[model samples]
Target: MSEAIRIRVTSQHLAESSNPAQQKYAFAYHISIENCGREAVQLLNRYWLITDADGKKTEVRGAGVVGKQPVIAPDECYEYSSGAILDTPVGTMQGYYEMQSADGNTFQAPIPVFSLVVPNLIN
Candidate 1:
């Protein structure tokens, strides 16, 4: 299994749904999962580690993403959008998916670390 799956992430600050004065920061993340192997794969479970600007860490573990366990065919991909709230303007998320191949073999597909930041907060 050569890089069985590829994960890409993008995020944005939802100012409309956030109250900076109240220490509430909202962010929405978009994840794209691409199957790069020779067989189809179904995402079974997900584990996430999120860290806020203040270094507060939160761990999330659940079945599938956003509610569905999608089966992705070879050369195909699935995408979803989800949101998170933090006590600060910056944070990061990283995790992996437990996947089962068409032949009933289970493996882990990792999702690299991605940042969630309010615009102009850095630089």
Candidate 2:
């Protein structure tokens, strides 16, 4: 039921939290997960594939987000903010969320690939 879910992402560079000289780049991403279906769904787990400008890739897998597995109601939305650290000034994140419907059916909601870039770094 891919059409039953919608995922949106926005990101910002945390300059204060990053040290370019030290090869540390920090970025914060805000996610909005909307349940467009008629049934409620619970987020079970998250899988992320982060790739930096240098072609370095890192994968992250965890239970829930922000320490909580939230149940989103029909036509409702759940939002959260989280950050990632990279070695380069630019990166991209894409993944999916494991979701369980009220009827015990499990499905994956895709997270669109979004950019993480430091301001003025990319032309």
lDDT of 1 by residue, 4-123 (tens): 799999999999999999999999999999998899999999999999989999999999999999999999999999999999999999989999999998888989999999999857
For residues 10-106, could you state the per-residue lDDT of candidate 2 as single tens digits? 9999999999999999999999999999999999999999999999999999999999999999999999999999999889999999999999898
Evaluate all candidate structures by whole-model CA lDDT and list the values in order: 0.93, 0.94
Error of model 1, residue 95, in angstroms: 0.5
Q: How far in Å is the alpha carbon of 121 misplaced in model 2? A: 1.3
Worst lDDT 10-window in candidate 2: 114-123
Model 1 clashing residue pairs (backbone): none
Error of 1 at 2 (Å): 7.0
